[model samples]
Target: MIHDTNDAIPHQLIHDALERVISSREIVNSDRKKRFLQFIVKETLAGNADRIKAYTIAIDVFNRDSSFDPISDPVVRIEAGRLRRCLEHYYLAEGAADRLQIIIPKGSYVPQFVMREVAAPTLLRALDDDKQSTSERLPEIVPAEAEFSQAPVAATSSYQPPGTAPSRVPLLKRPRLLAGLCSLLAILTIALAGTTLFQRYQVSVSSRAVPSQVPTLMVLPFENDSSDPAQNMFAKGVTEEVIGALILFKNILVLGADTSFQFRTETALRDAVPNVPIDYVLKGSIDRTEGQIQVNAALLRAADHQYLWSGSFRKDFTSKSMLDLRRDIATQVALILVQPHGVIDKAELQNTVGRPSESLTSYECVLRTREYWRQPNAEMHKQVRTCLERAVRIDPDYADAWAALAFIYTDEARIDFNPSAERPDPTLTALEIARRAVALAPDSPLPLQALGIAHWLRREPALSIAAYEQARVLNPHDSDILADLGRAYSLTGDWEKGIPLIREAFDRNPAQPTWYRLFIALYHYVNGQYAEALAQAQKIGTPNLVYTHVVLAMIYGQTGDRDNADYEVDEILRLYPNFGDKAVFEFERRNIDPAIISRMLDGLRKAGLDMDPDREVANEKD
Candidate 1:
């Protein structure tokens, strides 16, 4: 007997069943299906059920490489489904008489064995003795070939107990009748098979035909867990506030309040919208105690009920106004769950692995853009550029794709990300793309952000600030926009307003990128707070950007750390060999306030970077 605590089925029995099914004519024809079944069953038998995951199956059974990502490539999932149907057909036909049956349950790879009931031959033999009289008492007999012709055996194929055998009238003795029955069964079998094939074809087309779309989320109504009727109203208010805040994000699609409110529980939501493939659900409860509002919220992956993120927020309403408290909680929660590099973006990145650019949907292109931003580099930026270009070609109406592509164009022009590539004019190209994005999505914050960046690149600081401010108004929870607007303000020497805005953006987004700290560090350095500025600059790690090194060199130089300061200058020169000439040129062309530029240059000069135009020309001559 197998030593599995859950099942005591004999090991030999399972092995016999596996051999019978795999060697059967139904499974023997297809190598892929046969191997799929054999691999999972053997692994299960060997007590290696844990190794039967989709990733392992793709590698071991399908010859996929080590970089196989199950989410983007559905080969294993598709094969597992086909194998399951194949097993059903096998058991209903040739393996029906076997005492043990091997079955692979849905949504899992582990194989199981169940006992097949044996028929009592003696009961049929007794009825056959009195044929003439038994004919009247017996139910009409259906031929096994006719009965098992269908792929899925009908429920009417129920087991017959030993003593309750139906009387048998042999149709085989009437050769004409048997032949006609066989012909009819053959026609039915052909029609059923054709229908099944057609259905499978349709499923195959539907699975791959649809373009990848933005992940959708459904926010269930928050349950009121307090006795006060006012708390019930507050709960509903919070739910609506969250829904409103979530909808402001351009990437994710939040279900309408009407649709979301109809189902409060996850089970109820699934039962109601069986066909709606919601990717995530926001659910929680609200209660009030001692004049304080306590809200517990969790973000769940709708497919598996896995909690992707959860939070418990407590606010003292006695110290703050009720409306302010509600808005504050909703905005904070929304920012954490949907902002760039937040919970949803991180989860979506995992699903987008190994997907080729040409096959990406518009939404997937946008997701890929975020991946590039997470670790902004030249190689990944080119990949993202290709993806967005394809996305816009395939889905020209996707505003988010256009906006992301606009950023790529800006990067190419402003930073010379692809310095090898020559173009007539990328700055105007970026402006045109940004305008197109805004034309497509006038109300979306992402489009406005792209427009703002384009304007900034064009040296139109006022226009850039206007666009950033409008975008912030559109999506107040977007930390990137706030940060952009803050940087714009600071560049124009409105440090009073800019510093506070940047600080607020930082507080709102816990996952704000390392560069957001750059502005804060500069802010400290500008205020002559060397210790605080150095601490902040060190926290930024070694980012691959010339500005990061410049700021660090500035801070180190001010603190009289000559060694580290020289190292920072060397790193900057490594990135930009002719820093002396480039710095003077960039300072002349950039839209930054002249005073701020001069101050930053002063600090860089102190860090051992000879920022003299005269000496740079002399060195070239030498």
Candidate 2:
């Protein structure tokens, strides 16, 4: 082993060290690794660092075809990583006396040759930076400090021979003092050890215990590693793609870009996020060359800063390749989080397919519009419409955007009923857009689902059933598609078949939103399971909420529980006093089956629902 010295290392020494590593047994053992090492080093020394990229490495070193895709064929990256480990092994055992050290940091392909002492300092600083950054970012918990305030216990021994006599020695002698000091030192070390362990035990329990509910996540804005500011849009697009794909995780709640993008910096993120319990943080940087890109990401537990996963991906920089990158990364992150806990409930794990984006702007708009899903404000709804509208304007062939826009309009009709008679009907507009979506993407299942919704909303039950049945063939396990299909069957008065499919949807998605439980309640009501229907309806939150009260009132009324039904009506009236004068009854009459409408109206009438008394009487006559 070489000792530390103050003399400057020569340039020749670095080259010699590199040569030794490239020719060492570790490198020579693998044919692919030796060539990869030689190529990058030669490129770096020749001042062609920019050319030493994923595409170049794949073609020149690995003999890939001209149409080689760096995303699909990761041979170059795999070889580069292998070369790094080989160099580390060679230096540690065989080249220990070498004055210079060689290394390759992630996110770049250029080899770095430096004096041994200089390399040690940089690595030490990185460790220090990690420690400092961890404390600065996670404010709730910190490393325990060793306390030396308490005095150590005095030395004591219990041993005496039966025939032995005590020596005539004076107290506080030099020898006795030395023994006491040693004993006190040992006691102090043990005390510090125990204290630190106890503190770690407390932190471990608090931070590592997984909660009973589904995990929540927030995808923060990714940092751009490129020097050009123009690449910012690409970085943002990558972040959006990741969030969009992660939406398929039915058991996870992902925060939208609006809130996540607000915390652009680490300081802002840490300061703004402590109140909300986030289970993990997925963050990384994106670097791009002329025809290649590299992404480095780490998934860390928020509570204890434990790394669940960390990896780097280098790929060709086409938009389609980027889509593949996002899908792969999102799938890996979701599965890693769920695999250990045995919580993979949805069909997303089996469906890893993704379509290429014709226009990134349209794709970003589609991703941004999803943020307004749970939000009920008109302003948010307007934002969704504007984004999707502009998306289709920019890319007319964008099928997903058209389909999503269709769904938005259908929702506007269902949830945000307009009172102004002069405005165009939302259901009609949705039907037009849904038809356009189906025409554009005939092979895709999403447009078909949207078509089903539009047809059902337009009061064409048979057409809705046809569209839904086609969609079911394409994606049998999609919960949304199944739910829509079940609703169509209910409208057509096929309660037996519809009820099972809807129940299957709920079974496949244990952590679905509150509205899903309401759908189950509706299905159970149609199936004549009044008690189960009431129980499902009660799970929809406080009965004071309009939807919850409406579901409960109908269930209670049908079971001949008049007192409970009236109580639910009182809550509904308190929540929305104009229920009789509003569109709620109209929504039911238009969407429900004719055979079930009379029975439902009878229950509502007995519960004192004062909505359209004449219409109620007429329904009974039918």
Candidate 3:
């Protein structure tokens, strides 16, 4: 017999059961019984003995919390249930012939060892009867020791009373137990408080992780400080030139003109600089007289909004020193921005100038090209090509100008605009120009990015991906590089890997193009998630997403919604009249669904537009 005597309760129960079962010697090594014993011991030591019978205890432990509620919290009820099955299994296999019996009676928590002479046949019959009745009486409680000796053969044998509780066990009195628990709780409380305070201090220190490299600066649109309104363009030109010069240095993330212009109308300095969460902002005002220009510039630390550096420059336009003065101002600003790292010497600053002239012609050309590219029509494409061509001519070795020219041609081929005006083979031309730019300066990632796009357009996806990966390694924080990488991956049908890269790029520059949304939509469409594709397409505003109409028409057609499909098809035709069978052939070559083709043709037919419906049927036949 085993009694609950704190620590001994666990050992005594197992020791007594093992001894009795071994004495029977019917089956010497029972793996199941050994496993049950080990399970009970492990549970008790783990402070989960009360939940021993619950099947979900292991799962609850794995979840690492008490989020689940069990029906019974009684330790006795749980142990009794487990013990009955354990003893039954042991008796049937290991204790068939033993006169001395071990009984873990139904619905009783503790084990009982009954020493009685009993025939094997009668005991087997009694065990069979108990098995039949036990399952139905799962909630029933049996009389403690009375049921143990009440077997038919046990009536003839002498019964021994249960043993007294063991003396070696120490009693944990209620008052002492409560006091120990309170002390433990208090210790945990103090430890947790100290740990939390330490963590908070670590976080505060880490929030300002010392920038890994030189701190960057964004020379925001300078205020026109001149009294004459006509001089405003000259002031703007000076600010733009400064931005252009600073961008040549590989160390800086000069917020481009597109981004800086967003802040032009923002009355407050804080509102204008939204996307760039930087450490500093360079604010300046340029005032000009008939023959002289005065520029006042101040660099303010973004963290505390305090001024870190300030200076003023005066130059006469007619004097030969004017160009020298502009270069001096640029050199000084670059030095101040990079000062936290180290002071840049005059010789090093002079070396940064790849082109010595302070002429605004190339700068103005870049600005015009930017505007034209934004419009992205046939005429705009031609204008951009012309501007970029002129820029390259002005500075023969300008890698940026070459890259811009390559990008214009790449865009023409990518969007299926007129390509002959730019080059007979725009994609190949773009690739050659991009490769030349990279050959000239392999460290620059911009040319490599353009090279990647050319490879993508050439249908060499794997090579494109490799080139983009190389670009990312060179400039990890470049948003344009990230976006191009995402597009390359998406085009190659690796949507899962592509979406996150695009998302990171979007987080870096939200106002760039809506290509991220378009890529996501295409991924969904190809994967047979039509509704999701439509939803993502809608998030990209309609005016900006011209290709969305084509995708929407395809999605609606495939889903068996003819009316909506025809509506989208009509809209596409209205917007782009030249969209014809070549477009359909391109769609088919890209593995667009046949049902979508039928819907597009149907919409075009209903809109009274002339199209060769036979072309789709012939492609299918071929």
Candidate 4:
């Protein structure tokens, strides 16, 4: 009914495309994203595209109050970006061969339904038919022109200019023109053929190179071995809860319950489904002893039925509700399996052992960056940076790769990492790269984490904290984000709130870097516990940072150990020769508490560090 062009897309075709996208459990998993897409598509179909503004979406679809301001909140814009990405991924995968495309162009929310371009084989066949018809008509055109030339012109009867061989131009023009056109067509055909071959060769080379990919998982039907028949329902509920929790992790894909429950066991799955695409399968059993229920979970590699990890968790159902018990156990299992440095992450990293850097995919680059964080240094940072740079170049749409690369830039800008290596405007570059990651994956917490670091490097702690809080809301179990938020809060003089966050992070993932230990030491030092602070400081390993030595010197000085304090002060000066001169400036730049900075400088002076600029400058020279 809204047709204004010859090739208007059929309403049924548009609706079919929408169905294909929204029905894809893997692609558009978020109910919010699905709703966003459906609302815009229905609006466009109803000839109300103009009315589909951010305010309208917030009010109608998102259920926001009328007081919502787009500029301030930007929730609509953010979710719109996410929805657009989901649609793009859907088209690239399952909808690749569809006859129509539903695209939401940037800068607007209106959905455009357009007919897909002609298939390559069909287009080539059409071109061949056109060429054949042109060749067949060439003869008739030539004869018609010859007859016209032979008929002669009546107005030229009196022209008697002798010579010129009776004007041979008309006789030779057609053949020469035809020959030139044929030669041009032949050259084009050869060039196109060469280009096609080159492209195919590139594809072949890419295919031969093995790149790491995102791991997929399936939660199989759980077996109930308990006496109570109602425990069967409990086991099913746990499986469903686990599937729900695992789907939140962006790095791993979780197959839906409908698909995963078809087979009872791994062997049945393998025998029934050919070449199962899942990498890991989680299956568990439920058993009740007395008032307590026990859940034993096992993770198995789908390819060979090899068990990767197994754990037993028990909960007292009498003390807690059944729903809460299932959720708690599911969360524990999810955290153990999917968190950073967890089983799947370690397995994936191990799987990248023999792969060359050039063949490393975006996800592999991200995983490698995680390795660098655990053992941060100049050499490893450089290697990680190069890997991530190549990853973004290879796959521009990989948001995690972009985010990881931005983190490197942020470190370089803030810490002056490898100062001898000349670089330009790293701060702005870091922020821009982080923003690019956010734009690429608006709903992902990884990009938001990178954005928070970039903001912190730019000396915007408030904005940094805001980004981190949003990231925590998206994925509360990410320990790295929690530690980062704690660092932010502590640096801004909120130790009461910050220390617990840091402790929680450490409890969640104890295998973190030594820099985290420094925070705990500082927390003790602030509370006037010198022995505790000193003990915590000793656990920090080398290549130790300046802040680590500074804290050590302060704790030793406060505890009346002049020799150890002086040794720490000497280490600091040896590492940073003019630290005394820039110590205050550095502390302020890092957003430390004023009182803490004063106390630190006083302790340093007590430990024989001269705060005088002239003396520090002379020391640097000597």
Q: What lDDT does each candidate get?
A: 0.69, 0.58, 0.52, 0.69
**lDDT, candidate 1, residue 157?**
19
Instruction: Give TM per candidate.
Output: 0.63, 0.42, 0.41, 0.65
* lDDT, residue 292, model 1: 89
Cα lDDT for residue 145, candidate 4: 17
What does candidate 1's lDDT look like per residue over 16-52, in tens digits?
8888888775566456788898898888878899898
What lDDT, from 0 to 1, does candidate 1 have?
0.69
Over 120-193, each residue of candidate 3 has an lDDT whose tens digit, in order, gives 44322432344245324421321112121212111110111113131221323222234356546655765877
- Backbone N/Cα/C clashes per model: 0, 0, 0, 0
lDDT of 4 by residue, 1-622 (tens): 2232234676777788888888764344456778888898888777788899999999988999999888655567656765776676555433545667788888998877766565323211322343354346544321211110111111111111112233334423333234346546655765877654322222211211112367778788888989888677678777867876675566676666555565556566556545545789899999999788999999988778889999999878753376678767887888889877778988889988877776777788899888777767777787777788777655555667777887887778566665423346565456556655655554567877887887677676776787787677667777788889999899778998788888888787766565777888888888888888888889877544677789998888788898898899999997779888888778877777777777777778877887864432112222
Clashing pairs in 4: none
Model 4: CA > 4 A from native: 1-212, 263-276, 354-356, 419-422, 612-622
lDDT of 2 by residue, 456-566 (tens): 776666666767776655445465667678767765668777767877766654443455567678767867888888888877663334667777888887777888888
Q: Is candidate 2 or candidate 3 better by lDDT?
A: 2
In model 3, the runs with Cα more than 4 Å from the true position are 1-360, 363-375, 542-546, 559-563, 575-580, 584-622
What's the distance in Å from true for residue 396, model 3?
1.3
Candidate 1 positional error at 161, Å: 71
